[model samples]
Target: MFTDLALGALGHPRDLPTALELAARHGFGGVDPDVGHLRGLRSRTQVQELADDLTSRGLRWGIGGLPVSLTAAPAVFAEQLAALPQVAEILAAAGVGAVGTWVKPMDDALTYRRNWRLHVGRLALVAGVLDDAGIRLGLEYVGPKTFWSTERFPFVHTLAELRELIADAGAGNVGVILDTYHWYTAGETPADLRALTASDIISVDLNDARDDRERDEQQDQDRRLPGTTGVIDLSGFVDVLVELGYDGPVKAEPFLSTLAERPVDDVLAEVSDLLDRALAPAQELSRS
Candidate 1:
C-alpha cells in the first residue's frame, strides 16, 4: 500500500550505477531492467554485483523483461520460454520482486494452449525460484503486435479479457501488469478500470496519449506526458485506481526516443513535473 512510483530504465544508461542514479534522482522506488540493455553482463557474478549495487543505492529491483515477438514459430517461442529460468534466477539473486513479459508475436489460441502450457511449465520451474527467493511474475498484455496468431488475446484492450487471463494462469505468484497506453488504444472505457479487481493487477506503467493518434501511428508516443496529447481522462483513471485500492508503484514509461537524447536531468525533472501535475486535484477540498 506504499505510494511508490518506479521510473522505467528501458532507455536510460545501461551501466548499473548510472541506472541507479537515474532512479534515485527521479525518486523511483525500484528499477525495471530491460534484458537487452544488460547485454555484456551475462555471468552470474556480474548480475549479482549489479544487484548488490542497486541494494547499496537503496533501490529495489522490480522486474526483468525482453522485447520478444510472440508470433514467431513454436520452436522459437519455446526457446524463449526456456530461457526464463536463467532470467528469473538472476532477478532473484538481485532481490527483485518479479519478472515481467509481453506476449510474443506467435502467441495465438493454438499457441495460447501451447504457449500457456509451455509458459505454465516454465513458470512452474521458476515459481520455486521466485517463491524461495520471494519474487512475483507480471504478464502484461499489449497490442496485437505483441501476439497476433490468436483470434483474440489478452492485450489489455479490454479489462474483462485481461482478468480472465489472470484467473486462467492460476498462479498466486502471477498477475497482470496494466499499461495506460494499451488501455487507451484498446478503446476500453474508464468503467473497465472500476470493475477491475485489485488482485488481478501486479504492476502498473503510466503514460499519456495524444487524442488524434491511433495506437499504431506514434511509434514511440506512449512515452509522452499524461496531458500533452490525448483526451485520456486522467482524473477518471486516478479515481478508478483509488477505488480499486491499488497500492503499487506508478512507473513512468515513455517511449519518446527524443526524451532520451536530451539531458537526463532536464528529462527527469520535466517528467516528474508532468506526472505530479497530471494527477493534481483541479479544486481544493476543505478538511473534515
Candidate 2:
C-alpha cells in the first residue's frame, strides 16, 4: 500500500505543492490534493506543471474530490455534471486516476427512499463522466450511527449497502473508499473485509478514534492519529488489506482539532511516525 496524506484532515491545510514537499520530506509515497486547488488552476499547462513538480519531488498524486453534489436537484445536478468534462480533462492531464466524495446520510428534506433512488441515478451519471475520462469514482459511506438517529431510517452505512448501491447504479468504474475509522465505527470485522476483493476498494483512509468515546459518540473531527489510541484495530486492518492484495493508496485522515493548532512539520512528523507503525505489518507482508 502507498502511504498517502489527506490534506483536508491535516489540521492546518497546505497547498498542493507544499503538501507534496512535506509528504516527500516525511517519507510519504503520495498525497490526496485538495480539489479546490486543482479547480483553481487557470490552464492545462499549469496542471501539467503541477504534475511535473510532483514527479520531481518523487511523490505520487493520489485521488482528488469531485466538485459536484450527487444528490442535487435534476437541473442543478445537470449543470454540475456538465462541468465534469473540463475537470476530467485537467485530471487526465495531471495523471490523477480517481475522484472521491462522501455519501451523506438522509435528512428530513430528503427521505431515505427518495435519496437512495437519486443516488443510483446520479452516481450512474457521475460514473459515465469519469469512466469516459478513464478515471474511477471512489464513493465513501458515512458509518456513524449518530447520523442515523436524526434520519430514523435505513441509510447506506455499511460496505454491503454501499456495494448494493453501486450495483444498483450500474456504474462499472466506481468503488468504495474504505476508511478505517468508519469501518471500526460500523462494527465491521476482519472477517467482513475478507469477503471483499481488492478491486472492491478504490482507496483507504487510516485513523484512530478516542478510546474514551463510544462508537456512536465519536464526532467527525474527534479522531486520533493511527495507532495513537487503541480504539481501532489498525494493525489487523492493514493485515487484512495486505492479505487481500490491495495495492492502493492508504491515507492518514486524523481530524483532531489539536493537530491543527500544532506546527505543520510537527503534525506531519507525528502522523508519519504513527502511520509507519500502523502499516509495519503490511510492509512485512509485502516483502514476503
Candidate 3:
C-alpha cells in the first residue's frame, strides 16, 4: 500500500513548497496538487521545475484532482478544457501519469442535450491532450450532492454505465475514480470495485462509512478514519484492491473540517499513522 497526501488536506495551501514540505514530513509517497498550485506554469520547463522540487524532496508526483465541472456553461467548459492541457504538460514533465476531475453534468431538461453534447466534445478534446502528454484522465462520478447525483437512483448506477457514458463521449483517455465514501452512500456493492480494471481505475479515494444516520447532515461527521470507523471492513476492502492488482496509491481522503482545527502537522501525522495501520495487512500480503 502506497500513501499519497491530498493538497486539500493541507487546507488548500496556496504554494507548492509548503504543501510539498508537509507531504514529505508526513511520509507521503506523492502529492496530489490542484491547478492553482502550478502558478504561472505554462510550458514543460516550468512543469519540470516543479517535478524537480518533488524529486529533490524524495516525493513522487501524483495527479492534479481539479474540481472542474463539465455541467457548467459551454464557455466555461472550453476554458477548462484549454487549461487542462497545461495540467497534462505539468504531469508529463513531473512524471505524473494520472489526472482527474470531479466534472459531472447535471440533468437539465431545458438544455440537457446541449450540456451533454458540450461535455462529451470537451472531454474528448481534453482526453486527446492528456494522451498526447502521456497522462490518463480519471473521470470521477460524483455523488448526488454534486451536479450529477447518483444517490437517488442507486440501482441505476454502475461503473459499466459510466464506462458506456465515457464511450459515448468517445474519450479513450478518460476513466473512473472509485471513491469508497460515494460508493457506500450511493449504495453500491463492494464487489463493484472489482469490476473495474487496474488500468481503468485512474485514482482511488479510500474512506469508510458510518451506520445509517443523517448522511447529508453528517457531511463533516461521516468520513471516519480507517479502523476508527468500525462500520467498514477495512481488511475486506484491501483484499479487493489486491485481488484487482491495484498497486496505485490507496489515498486516505477524509473531508471532516474538524481535522482542520488541529495543527496541520499533527493532523497529517495522524492521517498517515491511521492509514498505515489500516493498510498494514495488505502490505504484508504483497510482500509475501
Best by TM-score: 2
Select the stronger candidate by lDDT from 1 and 3.
3
Deviating ranges (above 4 Å) for candidate 1: 1-11, 34-52, 66-83, 104-133, 143-157, 214-223, 278-288
Worst 10 residues of 1 by lDDT: 279-288
Off by over 4 Å in 2: 152-154
Ordering by lDDT: 2, 3, 1
Off by over 4 Å in 3: 10-14, 42-46, 66-68, 108-118, 144-158, 212-222
Write model 1 residue lDDT over 139-251, tens digit each, in one string.
76664233342455432334565566555656677777777766765666678776667766777766776667555553333446666665566667766766676755566
lDDT of each: 0.59, 0.85, 0.67
Candidate 3 on 159-269: residue-level lDDT in tens?
655676688778667888777666655556658777777777777777766565544433433476666666656767667777777767667777666776777788789
TM-score of 1: 0.72
Q: State how far residue 262 of model 2 sits from its true place (Å).
A: 0.6
Candidate 3, residue 106: lDDT = 48
Provide the clashing-pair count of each candidate structure: 13, 0, 1
- What's the residue-level lDDT of 244 in candidate 3? 76
User: Ten-residue segment with the worst summed lDDT in candidate 2?
Assistant: 146-155
